[model samples]
Target: MEIQEKKNIYVGVQTTQTRDIRDFFMEIDSYKNILVFAEVGEDKVCDNSLELLGEANRLKNIRNNDSFVIAALVGHNVKKYAPTLFGYGADKVVAFDSPMLEVYRSDLYGEALAGIVRTYHPEIVLVGATALGSELAPTVAAKLRTGLAAHCTALKILDNGQFTQVVPAFGGKVLGDIYIPNHRPQIASIKAGITKKLDYAPKDGVVEDFSCELNGFERMKVTKVEKETETCKSLNEADCIVVGGFGIGSKEEWSKLEELASLLGGANGCTRPVLDAGWVSNEKAMIGTSGVAVRPKAYLGIGVSGAAHHTCGIKDSGLIISINKDENAPIFACSDYKVVADYKKIVPALIEELKARKG
Candidate 1:
């Protein structure tokens, strides 16, 4: 926190950006409403999609032309989720349901989302930065010829109606605030867990069906889909996470991290190298841009060198405690607490203390 304060003092947080209405293209004035891509799974709107709606509702400006929170649902039998959208804060829902969208093809989903944006002319477009959304958001933005801010941690609208997008840059060293001052639709893909879902209410909202022909493709075929079975709670759901890195040295060492997590009633995760080393068989346990981004209440790192790729994901953790032998490891800069010691010493002591307390 002191390092961040120093940075804030030396280098101002570049948060303000503005543009005159005259600077905007003539058609830019046509944009209205905050359109959120409502990603549906298992016949229900995904929580990340609901998170986007709640955030959009919170950021919507009525004075700036009554920016309604409009959710664009595109999937097979997605109309069933219209009420769920309304309950979550959507003022209106536009549904595009078809067999083509049943299976997520980037082209198909992108077309559906792009078509919705073109037709709606939304002032802002929000997408959850999931595996699917990371691909779909860029594809739609390209099709619409608009600027998109990907993997944003924060978003806000200035009094001048400029949309601000905040993302971590330089490998979580500093936060970069981006703005789309002239675009008709300011598009952004929000990283999951940055915000929570709104409370459900029996609010009435309008649902509209949008019909369009999608170009067919046989470039790829999915014969069968299988879901990955996770042995531990998802990183997003766990309040605490015990993460191991390649520095763990051996498969046996990695087991200690898992043991710690299990005892704490939390989840276990690893950096990419730990998985590559064959210490972790569950690929879903990797945390980074290549994996899940977690914001747990407490995150304990064992032998983590804190590469930017890994730190970017853990930077938001509430209480980051890194245990490493290297005094100069990069993670110490960002962690709330640091223990310059070997995991072999810290792990056993921690486990013993917990067991003693239990007894």
Candidate 2:
């Protein structure tokens, strides 16, 4: 197929949020190209980053190769992986190597990215929803003063030469479609796992290393980097999840919920109130909207009210069994099966039944 070159449409890329915010605006596009921000030395480029490239490649094909994909990296050893990123579909890799970029500080990375975007006006900009990504994407959007969408689950190009950003709203109960109709560049941040990565193919592309001048605002001082200690497997990746809500009644009764989860080879999760009440760690809590979205093999909702926020996260689970005293609870509507009884009485009995079944 003959690849058509798009005279418009450019994508701006930036490192994870730890970099300078202004770096997002440094580019001026003479033609249509997708810019991918390469996070060097981070070892793991976020899954969403590769997903964006894949989508861009797909768009390129749909546009008959009228567009090209360009990757931008800022680090000391960026040249090493230029070939790898190109193989993944980038037509060009722009490198900005420096010691300052080694450690990501939002101020520095943001500045560098912003400068690039301003110099090259891309039609669209994509970033991962990581800690650094969340921080930097919004800042760049704000700086560029353009429309920005967060936590998008899907992205596509409309036939009319516009980008469509789809995300879950009201706690995943509904999908919201967003677009920047009048903006020069529509910006969106995509959640990981929502999209798939494309296979790497052989491609010949140019790798250009350019020296950058870091100014005062571009240099953000770091006082400390405190690492979090209480690490647990993310709920989104769990095989099974047992969630409790206000109906669990008391902190003392949590053990019953934990026991049931253990039997099923699952981990314990909770609603917002339970986590706020200190019954479980925040990481173990499974509330709606604010927590991780999960699609486990089995989800046991104990005493949950089935509010829009709480139920939205678990709707994707393969099996859902809800335990509530009130048959009319909103949660019942979404459950595969429902048990109308007091959790205090039924939980212990259910645990025993599970154990007996195992035996």
Candidate 1 residue-wise lDDT, 1-359, digit = tens: 21231122112112235444433443777888899999876667788899898899888742356678899999888898898999999999999989877888888888888888888889889998888898989888776766788887668776876667866566556666676655667888986666667899878888999977687633466789886566768888999999998889999777778778988999999998998989998877888755667889999998888876677677779999999999999888889899999889989999988878878
The prediction achieving the highest lDDT against the true structure is 1
Poorest 10 consecutive residues by lDDT, candidate 1: 5-14
Highest-TM-score candidate: 1
Off by over 4 Å in 2: 1-31, 36-42, 58-65, 74-92, 168-175, 199-206, 218-220, 245-251, 270-278, 283-290, 304-317, 324-342, 357-359
For each candidate in the order shown, give its overall lDDT on alpha carbons. Answer: 0.80, 0.70
Q: For candidate 2, lDDT tens digit of each residue in 1-359?
A: 11112122222343356445654543434435566665553465555577677876776776664677767776666677777777777777777777787778777777767666665566667776666677888887877766678766567777875667765555445556676654445677765444556897877788876654566765457778775664544666678888899889889999888888888878788888898888886543554544555678888899998876566567668889899999898888889889998888887887889999999
Clashes of 1: 0
